[model samples]
Target: MRILLVGEYSRLHNSLKEGLEALQHEVTIIGTGDNFKKYPVDYCIFPKYFLQNRILILLNKILFRIFKLDLQLAEKGIRFWLFLPKLKNYDVVQLINSNAIETYPFFSKYLLKKLFNQNKKSFLLVCGEDTPIIDFMLKDQLKYSILTPYLNDSNLKSEYWFSLKYVQKNYRDLFNFISLNVSQLIVSDLDYKIPLPEKILIPNPVNTNKISFDNLVISEKIIIFIGINKSSYIKKGTHFFEKALAIIAQKYSDKIEIISVENIPYNEYINLYNKAHILLDQLYSYDQGYNALEAMAKGKVVFTGAETEFIDYYNLTEKVCINAIPDVDYLVRELSLLIENPEEIIAMGKRARLFIKKEHDYINIAQKYMDVWNRN
Candidate 1:
């Protein structure tokens, strides 16, 4: 199959491309290399004018504050307009998000129309919570979501201005247009599934070949690692994890070592946590995200979302991953339990690696995509 995957955010499409190629399928990816992470792509559409140049970058801030205009958006508009003709003649085209080009609805809708006309089959991936998904989250459909902090705390609402505004009538129109035009809508995780009940559910692909399982050795002192992305700190419930970590650090100062790194590049980020015993991932997801799954593939104990839906899907009573919650007390207790019982940590790490190898191996995920694409 000649598949064209559009947009890259979290190395999701890059890993999927690797899997498809392994299965002898022709796959092409067009993306911005996800900023500093720099994932591979056949076509790079990163708008470089204002963001890369120092003087223009400084001026962009001024433009945003005074005229309420974004230079970065303008760059994307120009680049995507020029790149539209190249986005044709693929057997299948998959969008990373509704606003894959990071432009206004007017432009995105215009582009989607062209995409629909050009491609044989076009699908949308409900990767992150989009406009409609954000609307559903605001309605509290799930037991808990990343939006929980914004809904419960007024102070945190400011941090999510984009999401709140995106769900409004104007922004949602773009998503509506894409939904009507796309051949199918597929979700990579449960967070998107709650809002989109009818959409196909496919687990995110993990490149297990790149990640090797090592039997975690729990020594006298345990190393706990938490990597923070400043953009999604509040949304990912980082404060809750930090508060819980604070108490754990004070209580077991000698037995535990906490490592906190913020907004580093992808390669350095992974290597930074390589020697760690535990990885604390997002607190608001209903399924394991890219980071958690990758850590699990490396045989690390990851504290992430493993809700009932995820548990039931895998059909295992054994706890391969720790369900991270928003409550500080609950998080503290869970960390304490793991700290006290070192042996369980090693056992859980092994189970977590096996789970990733079985459920998220990229080759199997690629076959699932192929099956969906071939279906009438």
Candidate 2:
């Protein structure tokens, strides 16, 4: 199968591409930059046409009106549409939503579906909450995949500008919203309870192999948090993580080591994970994102709980990490428990690594995608 995967998240590119190739499928991950020399891949540098000035905006409007330019979206909107043919040639197009950028592209996608003629179908893989999914599906029977869906709370300020109109008129429109146009909804956690009729539980695209479980030693006293975005704190309770860690460090004195892998490359970041005892995944988001997976692959205990749905699906109650809310007191108690039972922590650490390897190991993720493509 020729799968044209579109997105810029590092996890999506590394794991999904590697997974697909292992299955002997032609996976071409189209990205925004040309820095893919380290990996065998193709880079599609779509020009950014963000309008900054009124004069240029006016000029672009005139050019668009005269057919001098193709303004399907803002400007790059037209450029993305140029790849509409690529989507047609491929068996599936998993549209990964990065930081809510899917809003701007919907205009191009809607226009292209109308203007372009295609033989094959391309599916939109929403990062869980793309308001436009309701619009595109309702306005024109389109449905997409919800990979790692957020809880059914759309109050956060994404590209939708927090509008309820973005939701379809009724539940009848929701029928198409489930699949938009894809076969199955690729999900990382079974914790999502939004009534997905065609939900396919899959591993999040995490390259667990890159990190080694053998490298984690109990002598390491470091406590680590790897968040790439501060905005994650607002939703995932970054402050809570910080406060909890503060209490542990204060109580343990020099015994507790804490580090935040915010801005760094993979090698440097993984080194911190190697030198750490615990990994703090988000408390706000119910399911762990790629960071937690990475830490787990390193045989580190991730301090976050899976949603009830995910827990029930896996029959998972324990054997790995401790699940807790953002309450500093709860986190402090969990840390104390781990510190007291160092052996248990190590046992859970090993279990966490095995969990990631058996579940989200990039190879299985790729195979899952293939299954989705083949309707299995």
What does candidate 2's lDDT look like per residue over 212-267, in tens digits?
Answer: 56745667464555444443445456677788877888888766667775645555
Which stretches of candidate 2 lie above 4 Å from their native place? 33-41, 45-78, 82-88, 97-106, 111-119, 132-180, 191-198, 226-228, 263-268
Best by lDDT: 1
lDDT of each: 0.86, 0.57
Model 1 Cα lDDT, one tens digit per residue, 57-83: 989999999998888877776677787
Q: Considering only N, C-alpha and C atoms within 3 Å, which residue pairs clash in candidate 1?
A: none
Instruction: For each candidate, give its TM-score against the true structure.
Output: 0.96, 0.73
Top-TM-score structure, candidate number = 1
List the RMSD of every prediction in angstroms: 1.5, 7.1
- Assess candidate 2 and give its TM-score to the true structure: 0.73
